[model samples]
Target: MSTVLPDQLGHFGRFGGRFMPEALIAPLDELTRAWQEAMADPEFTGEFDRMLREYAGVPSLLYDATRLSEAAGARILLKREDLNHTGAHKVRNALGQALLTKRMGKTRVIAETGAGQHGVATATACAYLDLECVVYMGEVDTERQALNVARMKLLGAEVISVKTGSRTLKDAINDALRDWVASVDKTHYILGTAAGAHPFPAMVRDFVRGIGDEARAQSLELLGRLPDAAVASVGGGSNAIGLFAAFIPDAEVKLYGIEPGGDGFETGRHAATISAGQVGVLHGARSFLLQDEDGQTIESHSISAGLDYPGVGPEHAWLADTGRASYRPITDAEAMEAFRLLSRTEGIIPAIESAHAVAGALDIAKELGPEATILVNLSGRGDKDMDTASKWFGLIDAPEAGRE
Candidate 1:
């Protein structure tokens, strides 16, 4: 509901700042100015709105999972972001950044992605806008999410596999940032999530804030009121922020940010940054990050590649500190269970990242019972995850021919 954040110095209550190299500062400032101008200009905003409606397909569905509702003994509603054009909510920010890249007269756009959804979304926007697109993804991710890699290449994007560090999202970000610094004059770096420096955390959220805006209106129109709780998985916090922004002013609605609790939190193998991390700087922003006592960043682990990063959006840190929103960690087993439950009960195969939210909602639903309502942000479809899901559930092998 409120757009006030990252005040003059880009500090979101000490959680966010321009904590990057000197070479990056000027470009970030330029991006900030361009985004400010775009936000204020009706011509730009009007065109963006039109593009989202006509091309990107905004106003994604909000479906009531009647079976899940009955099973959980509470009304469960799903914010169907999985239905978006790019098969995820990443398109919103991608399109916004692509528009800015065009307006800035940049010849190329670069992005970093972990799960490849953001890279695919960026590639799609670049194709639509005729911009040269380059996406840097971790070597490991490129192998695991081969489907998305091929999708980006099909969209005419050059996908570079970074073989550095842990060979995951963090490495991808490092490579993308290095590339941006070298090519800042003729290129725009489209950071994938709402966790980057300054304008990015705020800008990305503004672009995807429609999730919460529409969900609130839809809930009121269909359910006759707002939901008791709003839940979303927080991998860099874009979708969660988008779904929480419009409800921030509504004190009655509770916001739940679910982080990946790989294996279990006690096993030290989770990406539950806000839940089990300390304040630190990572990938240009000072936020809650998984780190060791020596101040070195710790590699985060999660079955869902999308949530396998150590840092989160700065606004989330602010919200958590202020107690305006609660952060929860959903374990890998819990998320997998929810993934199967949703697929069986609602016939919707949610992205693994989204299943974290479903798991959280199921927990809350059990506690709140029949009268409470929960809204879950089904962030992406599970088509890209079919391989992983099938293997995880041991369904990769065909059934025995004689089995009944």
Candidate 2:
């Protein structure tokens, strides 16, 4: 319930801080100042609220999952963020940063994406705001998430395929940072996750906390009391933080942060950062990192692009340390099964990231068994993953690689 910063020296208890080069320090400091100013402005608040309602469709509903509830022997509720404009909740952070860009007199936005969801959201905002947008994505990601790549281009954003180490979201981030440093005068980095340097971790999370705010009011209105638990998947931990903020002080509410357990934790092929990771630093945060014994980060694999990260948000690290919330992992197989179940039973196709939460809720609900109520943050729609899912689930049984 405390709004104060945690961790030592701007860290979520050793999970967050600014650890860039000295050349980047001044610009980051300037950004923090500007961000502080914008956040305090009532005019900015007014515009943001209007945009959330008119553009991104704020107040996404908490819908009852009637069929899943019955089968699981507990009432299921879904915070339908999947219905957002970009088919995911990433838009909330992108739009918030885009607004700050305009307010700060910036003319360009640069970002990095994994599956390109954040890139698409940033491009969508730039199109509306008429700002120059550039997205950096892993060359490998460009091949896998080609539709999103095309979508960004169609929105008049330049897409650069990063070819450096890993050629994935992390590499794209490095490229974006280089570009940002080059264009400091005209550009702002719209970080996609609740992980990153100082203000970004807190700022992005604050923007997304709106999810919890709305869900809290809606859940209370419908149930006449808080649900027994709140559940969401954690990648960079934004959606879970968003959905958990309002319920943090609710002592009776159980908060569960689910991570991707690729082929189950024992197989060593999962991205279960919170569940199986050790304390380490990565991507500007010292959170639960999937790292090797030599202190280098490990490769993380997850069927869900959104949840495929080696490190988690700083806030999640603090939560874990403080024991305020519990985190668990859901295997890719389990999540996919939950995805199919939701589609078949509830007529809803959840994002692969959100399906982790669904998979966790299924496990939890059956145990609660006809007594408690559960709400899961359905953070995104699964249409983006349909191609991958079809192959993964043997729908078409594509070749060894999707390209073949």
Candidate 3:
């Protein structure tokens, strides 16, 4: 929780630091210097704030989900990031990084995505800023999140389908890093998560920390105090870290990160990195990774395309080790149940990734009882998940002949 963390070398107690090819060192250093200077400049900060407020929609509502609270047997305060432009919290990071790209005189931006939210957000930012945008997405994720793919394309991004290992989030990152190495001189890799090497985890966290900042102040206004706990679903830990950063200084508030327990952790088919992973390196940073005894990365599974990753952000690894926060697994079944429950009870269909936190809040509510209040980061909306959700719950039926 020390503000000086990540040290001068970009390490979060050994969990985060650059582990990239020699070609990347210069660009990464350039990016780090640019970000540091931007953070210190009011002109840069003012422009970023204006864009967030006028374009991406900041200070998203902290809604009191009365129905959801009643169903969970606790007071549930939902930080509705889902309402932001592009329907996810990824926009904040995308916009901030895009601005930095412009400041650094980079005219092209490249990104990697799972669930396609980040890709769409990056494309959106590029379109707005007149930068050329390219997004790499795993083939598997592209199929499951086709709507988001279309969204990115419509926003003027060139989308490439990665057909490499596992064909998911990790593979998308693998391909994106390859592209960065070749094009670092003119292209900026707007990493979507609070992971990757050095400045990425720290920079992405700073961009999205507004989520926690707004929620914290809103909590004080509504509840007269902080909630008993803050909960969010973790894949690469962007949203979770954003929400957790502000609350870290408040010792009374507990933080929980829900990981994807695809099928179940016992089945060896899940993305529950923090819950069931070992220390390892992946995608240019050391973090908790799902790896074999020989250190080969294992393929991860998840019902939600976004959370299907083999490694977690380094800050999350540090938080888990330090016990300042707790990470738990929520199975696909559990997440889906909460997904449907929220849609019905609160009329808000959350992104499947966010449903993991909703499911965890249900369990936490039971533990803390009805009197305890909980804040949940509803990180994204579910419009892009209609295809998967419809199939999951059998809402789609076989069409009758001539129906079209």
Candidate 4:
């Protein structure tokens, strides 16, 4: 199918643009040109495909969820991104960008991460390519996602804890951007998701489009046709975009992006950008942003560190506005419940971020009923969330008596 989006100037309607410091404009344009040239080169794409197969583990499984399907009253199928090399879909973009960095003759790679999956993936890629790696993470996130931080460090990345702003993902981005500005000549900022400046939203999405490409073919091969719905969790929205890209022209396939509803959007405690946000510029892209009356970005909260963000990808905002796709809020309680349900029913412990999609699929499945088939992107594994999960489910005793 033909695709028509993110027009010549890198806009998904009015949502995406080069809204950044003047200094970043030239670099972004250069990167965009390089990416376009590489995409057109058969040898470049061929090598990328080879790396995906030999290293990053492309073509992840599409598992049929028998018990979960019965519970949801629909045929639930999971696109198992969690089974990838670094236990998440983030590796796809990481390896792709790492190769691009090498092609551009950059020596070091830098990145910012929330739950640390992207940091781990970037670090892993740098290690594989023998490049220097640096990862910036929010101080709060570092504490909660300690395992992933250790994993990044183990992979030889120098992890920096940003103690600014809300001490979360946004702050990490701020610091990473500053680092990139100073070290652009030798460093490549591996923007983790499908957000940020012009090329980033497009570049990262293209790098990871394999998710949708594979799932589309796999669905037809295994189920005789495409799925009725495609559901995935959205923070910066890379995974969701990657899964949505291949089906954009399939009018029969519905797309749903699950945002972190946290306590509730009503309480002003969630990261439900599309559901409760306005068009504003943040982290370069003009998209649905959680902000105040004066347009200052509000701090986003979510039990899942990965979903704690105030802005979404520009393409998602365009998709919502154009009525081509929909976005829904999934609260922490609902996400955790779905997390446990999947573990119990399918013996799969999905990351809390992915649980949002699982919960959303369950909700959608109810309306669609048994005849419809739902495909949910199981974005990552829950191994890194054992501590948080243990606390939430009371699986372990508190450190101090009556701590709560």
Give candidate 3 regions above 4 Å deviation. 399-404
As for candidate 2, its clashing pairs are 7-13, 73-370
The residue pairs in collision within model 4 are: none
Q: Write the per-residue lDDT of candidate 2 for residues 202-267, one digit (tens) a residue.
A: 889888899999999999899999999999999888899999888888979999999999878888
Q: What is the Cα root-mean-square deviation between model 4 and the actual structure?
A: 1.3
lDDT for each residue of candidate 1 in 296-383, tens digit (9 for 90 to 100):
9899999899999999999999999988899999998899899999999999999999999999999999887789999999999999
Better of 1 and 2 by lDDT: 1
Q: Worst 10-residue stretch by lDDT in candidate 2?
A: 395-404
Per-model lDDT: 0.93, 0.87, 0.93, 0.93
lDDT of 4 at 29: 83
What would the per-residue lDDT of candidate 4 be over residues 4-23, giving only the tens digit for each residue? 67887779988998788888
Runs of candidate 4 exceeding 4 Å displacement? 400-404
Measured with C-alpha atoms, the lDDT of residue 40 in candidate 3 is 98
lDDT of 3 by residue, 1-404 (tens): 58567876678887999888988988899999999999999999999999999998888999999999999999999999999999999999999999999999999999999999999999999999999999999998888788888888899999999998888888999999999999898999999999999899999999999999999999999999999999999999999999999998888999999999998988999999999999999988999999999999999999888899989999999989998899999999999999999999999999999999999999999999999999999999999877778777878785532211
Q: Which of candidates 1 and 3 is the stronger one according to lDDT?
A: 3
